[model samples]
Target: MTRAEIFKEMEEMFGLVPSMFKSIPDATLELEWSLFKQVQLAPGEIPAKYRELMGVAISAITKCRYCAFFHTEMAKLNGATPAEIEEAVHYAKSSAGWSAYVNGMQIDFEQFKREITQVCQHVRLARESMGPGDMSE
Candidate 1:
């Protein structure tokens, strides 16, 4: 993907283009790429750990090695211990087959989302205090 192509897509998504986008082409797989872009930017409705757990579960179920690795990293970033992450995957394996898992999952999701939202708000507040960015909006 040419740098121009990536910047163009980033510009469209967040008003300002991120230079990192230039490392990949957005048009080559627009459909999947767009979905990925949305997922990356969409607000989380659960704790980052929970989201990472879900990602791991989904990846395991879907047998996506790349996603498994990615979510593992995310889980670690969210301060999840390796044992906890492994437990999350085990829980997913045990219950993901049931249709009622959504409700159970939603419980965790809501909590995670709330926590993340609070953190974001706090960060915005801190950023406001420092006047490093226009976080008031």
Candidate 2:
């Protein structure tokens, strides 16, 4: 699609095209907007609320103030509670902190993968052993 066509679509979809879309190069505007619509704006396997919360978390981790603000508001509009938003940020922070430690210490990737696989297998087996109506244990 041409930049003009994409701009028209954006205006129709959003009621007003954002300046950020205008800043994208004409050569790449169509492709960039396609990706943005598919991943960010469109509803898919993930619900909109979680997707927006994920955006907020990612923006916070990346330290993008503009994206953080935008996504937080979007998440709230999509029915995310303040507590859920706070938890998402905390979860992002915890993941980043652990990543820093693991990468900084040069932890063994193969060992980590093996241990995670074993834990997953154990959990699967335990779940399978539980009878359909026996969730007590």
State TM-scores per candidate.
0.48, 0.81
Question: Model 2 — which ten-residue stretch has the worst lDDT?
Answer: 128-137
Report the number of the highest-TM-score candidate.
Answer: 2
Q: What C-alpha lDDT do the candidate models reach, one value each?
A: 0.72, 0.92
Residues 1-137, candidate 1: write the lDDT tens digits.
45556557767866985444444455554554566666753556787777887888888878899889888887887788888888878887787565366575665777868998999999877886885445555
* Backbone clash count for every predicted candidate, in the order shown: 4, 0
Q: Residue by residue across 95-134, what tens digits does model 2's lDDT show?
A: 9999999999999999999999998898778879997766
For candidate 1, what is the total of clashing residue pairs? 4
Q: How accurate is candidate 2 locally (lDDT)?
A: 0.92
Residue ranges of candidate 2 with Cα displaced over 4 Å: 1-5, 131-137
Model 2, residue pairs in steric clash? none
> TM-score for model 2?
0.81
